[model samples]
Target: MDETTTAGPAPATTVGPAPVGPAPAGTAPVGPAPAGTAVAAESGGWLELLADDCSPGDIQRLRAALLAGADDATRRRVESEAQLAETIRARLADRGRDARELRVRDDLVRRLASLRDSAGLLQEVVAQSRFLLGVDVAYIMLPTADGGRLRIDIVDGSLGDTLQGVVLRDGEGLGGEVMRSGRPLWSESYLDDGRLRRVRSVDSIAVSEHLGGILGVPLRFGRSTLGVLLAADRRPRRFSDHEVELLAGLAAHAAVALRNAQLFEENQRAVADLRQSNEALKRTDELRRRAGELREQLTAEVLRGGGIPEVGRAVARAVGLPVQVLGADGARLDAGPGTDDIDVVAVTGSAPERWLSGQEPASRTAIGRDHLAVVPIRMRDGCAGCLVAVSDVRIGDETVRLLEIGAMTAALVVATERSVAEAELRTRGAFVTALLAGDGDDAELRRRAVAADIDIDAIGVVVVLDNAGQDERAVAAAATRIAAELHGWVAQHADRFVVLARQHDVASVRARIAALGDGDLPAAGGIAPAAGGVAAVRTAHEAARQTAAVLLALKLPGAVATAAEVGPYRSLFSHAGRDDIAAFVEAALGPVLAYDRARGRDLATTLEAFLGQSQHHARTCEQLCIHPNTLYQRLERIGELLGTGWREPGRTLQLQLALHLRGLAQTLAPDVGRRGNTP
Candidate 1:
């Protein structure tokens, strides 16, 4: 180092060979020595190897040369070149791999973005996975509700149709194993694979579809495995680890999409159900509100003292339907204008018998396309009537309930009205009784009668009803009808109904009484003469009672004996001292009366007829409808019964008066002659 360091610069040019040197006798000649030549040759080979295309083996050879004998410069050059080549190759490979991965990710993103809904999302996921994974078929198998099986949901690829809608139990197929384990699974040859339990149906489908290699990855959301995403190939081949990884990645994306779709569908169904429930509630509330309104209207009408017609109209307006009120006898009570054609009888008749029984109200749709709702108008005693409503369309349950409420209200109103009417009638009856009894002065009676709505100025008759063995209620009801017909007033008197009517109404009152017929013991009635003022009313009442008593005694059952019709008999009977009258009748007509009684003959009748004809034989015969000889013989018999001189003027006058008196006695008290006494 010391000697070299002191030297100046060495020549850069190469020296040419000089003179040939001779070799020593025993020593080898040192002409261009082989060791230096060999070193130069190795260095050149390394340089060429590094400069040209070379393999790992060539680079290794170059490295060996450097380690063996190459200079520092050659070694450094070879090391640098080798590192550069290695780096270039590695970078190129990485770039290519990255590009392929980027394409797959971009395709997946594009497909996911294209989906507008869950169904489309599922289909695209399966299709994209199938295409990217390069499998024969791809499908998604979602777990069933029970979590014991998987149903093929979306399928794609060449043989996708063959596997569509296939189902597999939890441990049945490759896909089922993946779902059960919540992990990925693969089978190169599924038919021969024993690791996964085989199902004949699933295997048959696989066989039919010519599927061999299969790879399944669990589709997971949160901690739960929702299903399996599967890829299958037609030919038997082992699935590369990279391929399985790629499929699992696709399956992960698919799981998220499928879960989102399921949630979306569930949300949509829930929203629809909620909407329907809201509508139903709204309708129910509306019906309740309407029914409440109707009930209020009906109650208001009833409280206002509305009658049947007014109530019917109010109900019709409230419910928008036609209404009918029927009496207990099934008669139409509301006979207002325009109601005659309503066929109320038909409505009532069509009502269910149970309603009439006063149990619960009922409603039905009638044959005439009308909805009929009927409710029994029940009172404390019984069902007094029924309220019916008819509508063009069927009503709701709420509306029917309202109708029932209205019926109850109407019934209460009717009962109240009846009670008021009865009270008024009682008051009127008491007034009439006091007046007939002559309990007050004429002026006081007249004033009281006016206040009672009795027409003192009008000529009125008194009618005495004999309601023997008949229901007092029926008699009272009948009297009411008579009063209505005669436009008069009726009052209860003892066990009879006494009616007061004007002279013109007397005949009508009598006719009405006749129409009522005899009740129980052959009902008898008597009419007093029409007269004005309260005094006359008292007299007429007495006269009517006497007449009724007379008719009853005479065995004239169901007879209406009037004062004017009975004539002189009423006048004579009114002079009662009935005992004296009976004595006089016995004295004058005793012999004839005795003869008639003993033989049950017409001796008394013949004597009266002979006197009635004024002693003319032919007229007497014609009056008695007998032959002259028969009349003569009957007259001789009467003379014998009456004793001699009975046909003389003085005797005939006494005998005629006695005959009239006898008839009067018979009418006044039919049992008088039998008892030989007066009543």
Candidate 2:
């Protein structure tokens, strides 16, 4: 068995004293040893020479001189002590080397425990491996993906990349054998080792690296082998069993480190994934919470009978973007807080057809410098309108859902409004129609009119709309809206619109309605003089109808001809009004003449009866033996036939003078003018 343990075999201890040559020059001068001084070898110079530290040559020379004179027994004892001293010196040297090797191995183990990842751990293992075993180079080979071969994973103290990514197959080299057997294998001279089946590529690499000796051990964990850990030298050398054991121990540590590194990486990845999932859950929860709150808010709006404006405001507050609502016709019905800053007209024009008819599903469409997101306001009939959100940036999918909820509520509100509006129009339209037909009792009719938001006491007179032959339904809708704004009511009667306006002046009421919403209003209308009572309202309706016919006959479309603006001389008027005395008569009597031609009854007679009696209705009714309503209707017809200017004081004088001239011309006979009698 080997007594000394270090990386290599220790020098063997010599059994005898070293041969003593001529005295070294530094030795103390020695007289030729006094031959006759025969000191005992056992006690005399030997003990003193041993006690005092002296050169081996001086000590040996002294023993030789003394022993020459002493017995042979003394000489033998001196040789025995010298041999023991030489053995002790060899053992001391080996003890120092062992101490150093142990320190290096301990440091490698400490560093291996500190590694954190597989790649870094493998690199540190190979580097420390070279130092611990005192080899020229070190490397580690891990099994390839298929485990059919081992590829060099890491290398330390290498001169080039010749062996990098190099593979060792089974039965190909010493590294391959270690991988197959899962055991330690080494050789004193790698090139000469017939035990290893060398491959051409590995052999060339080995020669290029100047490698002669090699040692490798399998990195084993439990029962399975991971790879090979190898150390090599550039010159031939014998690797002792102790060196082999040390390398195997390191390989064991490397295997454990590799496994630990893999587990550590997996744990880190798991933690990162968990953190990301947690953040996503938090975001999802936040969005759900916001959606719930907005839904409740919008539901409250619908339940409370809130309309589009209210719904728009609630959604705007939630989404921080402008919102607007439009009717099925794309008219602006209501706008929210931020809508004033947006181009409402542009938004309406660019809107998708789905807003009205829901032809397609909702999505985002880009408008100039803005984006529009719409949700159809679905109704029982079809899509009634749309709820729109305008933003400079794109709206997210979550916010789109919130807007959809708002649109749903808006649909309910709009549907309710439409139902109520239709019912109201029916009730009010019937009431106004009956009152104009002179059918209901005055007191009962007045009460019913009040219920329909019409103060019958405040109604002055009625105006009949010709509607310019436009759509009667559309015309009635516009007329009803105007009546509501004017605090009155509208009636649809036989393709003509009769509105009982509450205002005092017919011209003011006409202008007011034109301002209200006239896009669908008639271009022509006729007004009667201010009157009250159901009987008087009936006469007013006839007068308005006659004036509207006169306007139509005169080709005065878009003109509101009223009974208070014309004179009796309109029966003598002409086709065109120009700057002549004849033109003045033409402008004054044109509508009255047209009325007589169309109605086949002369309003010229009614004009003469009212204006000829100095605007006094009772005297005219007495002279004609007609009712007071008949006298009032004739005077009002004069105003309606001659449109606009004839009701003025100066205009009335011109009309009166014109009527007087026509009377004189009628009284004088054509024979009197032919006989040259100037009358």
List residue ranges in candidate 1 displaced over 4 A: 1-116, 146-148, 157-164, 266-289, 305-679
Best by lDDT: 2
- C-alpha lDDT (0 to 100) for residue 322 of candidate 2: 81
Q: Deviation in angstroms for 330 in model 2?
A: 16
lDDT of each: 0.68, 0.69
TM-score of each: 0.41, 0.41
Prediction 2 TM-score vs. true: 0.41
Over 1-679, each residue of candidate 2 has an lDDT whose tens digit, in order, gives 2111211233321111223233334443245533322342445544454344333433445656544665668667755654443344335445655676667667877887788878888988888777766778899998898979889979998889887888989767999999888889998899999999889888899899999789999999899898899999898977777778878988898898787777888999999999999987987798788878887998887788777898889988887778877766565668566677766457546445544555555666666777778777777766777777888787777677778777888887877886787687678767766776565699988888778876766668677777545765556656666666667667766557777777777777767755654432454667775567667777776667656545554456557767655433233232232124455555667678678889896776666666678777778788788898876676578677776777677877877765554553343223122221111
* C-alpha lDDT (0 to 100) for residue 658 of candidate 2: 59
lDDT for 467 in candidate 2 is 50
For candidate 1, what is the TM-score?
Answer: 0.41
Q: Write the per-residue lDDT of candidate 1 for residues 1-679, one digit (tens) a residue.
A: 4322212122211111111111122432223323432453465543444334333333433444444566888767756755554444334434545566568767787677555487688788777776666677888888778977789978886454667778889878888788788888898888999888888888888888888888889988889897888888888968766667777777777777777777777888899999989987897798678767766776777777677777666666666666677766465666544445566436445544456764444454454565677767778877777767766677766666666766777787788777876886787777777776667788887787777777765747788766453766555655666676566787876556787876555566566667655432245678886677777877787677666766665567568867666665554454456657777888988887788889899788878887898878888888889998888788788767777888799988988888777775665554332222222
In candidate 2, list every pair of residues with a backbone clash: 562-640, 563-639, 563-640, 565-639, 566-639, 570-589, 573-589, 574-586
Model 1 root-mean-square deviation? 24.0
lDDT of candidate 2 vs native?
A: 0.69
